[model samples]
Target: MTTPVLEARGLSRAFGHVLALDDADFEVYPGEVTALIGDNGAGKSTLVKALSGNLAVDSGEIKFAGEPIQLTSPTQASALGIETVYQDLALAPHLDPVQNMYLGRELMRGGLGGAVGLMNVNEMRSQSRVAFDELGATVRSLTTPVGSMSGGQRQAVAIARAVHWANKVVFLDEPTAALGVRQTKNVLETIRRVRDKGIAVVFISHSMPHVMEVSDRVQVLRLGHRAAVLDAKHTNMEELVGLMTGASTKGAA
Candidate 1:
């Protein structure tokens, strides 16, 4: 086994008396997609929030690249090469693909010519195009506003943006939740491309078939705890559903 690119041990979080995550343990490797599957209130949200620095962990340790680290905020996580794409997409509807891709991380023209804080439009466009091309994203027009693009196209842009800035792990929350069949396939392929680029993908989804198809491993959360981790190829939907619902106690083989 190889060292995990990202890992959490004994991760716990609480909302008043409710224990969201209870001594949870999770890990994902580079070049692989680890599907996080569970019923509602299974603590998947808490676990991911802790790892992504959206929520503080009550008791746990997060290690990145074999070193102990503290992710106190989303910016801190991003600084450490962690990027998350939420279900809402967090995109500007009025902005074009390039505009959305470089939203907050826009490049500023440097040197004496950059004294006035001019935006580096051409350079940003070039880089965005390269990222889209690399991921095989299907965007009809980079100049078109993101709101006008199809859901799949917007998803592609979101993913491309994440891939461009991500150096280690990318957390994708229900990436294909609102897509059609073809769009879902496109997003799934884009995910594979991300993995091919050697970035670990933490995919959260309720779709069993999607998980089984895209993930190298599946981690099931149950009642605020780590239920089981199964090899996707060897495990079937029945076994995974069983584990998630507390019908089984089997861990990864």
Candidate 2:
């Protein structure tokens, strides 16, 4: 009976004639992985955006750490230690790992150096290296541009960066797309490490096998709302697919 770290009820969002999120309800607990899966246009993306403060909900209630709060902007969410890593990874292709890690929130030097717009490059690099090491990410060279790295390495860097800054919740969108077996294994291991840090990991994916393998609880979305929230251990992929396709209603939340 652990309290959910993040919770939403009656969430709705519309785009002209289309309803992206229709009274969707979702929850994720601290220190556990929650998978959000659905067919195309089933409101998975919409719900992620709503909870991450990238999109406003037309109607609903959101509770963070048992307190109702409004996420008016991405900054507000970040302040609350909420970070989202989209499928794109959002890393700067040209910048190195250290640079990309502190892309927006760069550290400034002290006093005169700070007044002259000098960055604390050494400190940033040190912290970046520590983060990579802590996450068990294999980065041969932190100085190389992320564009040159393999997809899995780049994914590790992106996830490591998010985990370093996020203390409460991190929403990952399709972290293991198009990765080789070894690379995918590394990425999954990194996720377990993040969860062990007492952070809520919301994994959004279309791969049922990956979802079933990594998630503690699977929340299925159909049409525009939550169809079922089933224990991942007890539910099979066939049941998840059935719930997503509206072919079965045996596991309604």
Best model number under TM-score: 2
Deviation from native of the Cα of residue 131 in model 1, angstroms = 0.9
- Candidate 1, residue 27: CA error in Å? 0.5
Alpha-carbon lDDT, every model:
0.89, 0.90
Error of 2 at 30 (Å): 0.3
What would the per-residue lDDT of candidate 2 be over residues 135-227, giving only the tens digit for each residue? Answer: 889887889999999888888888988898899999999888878998888878888889999999999988898898889999999989899
Local error of candidate 1 at 195, Å? 0.9
State how far residue 123 of model 1 sits from its true place (Å). Answer: 0.7
Highest lDDT against the true fold, candidate: 2
Specify the poorest-scoring 10-residue window by lDDT in model 2: 244-253
- Clashing pairs for model 2 are none
Provide the clash count, candidate 2.
0
Give the per-residue Cα lDDT of candidate 2 at 1: 84
True-structure lDDT of candidate 1: 0.89
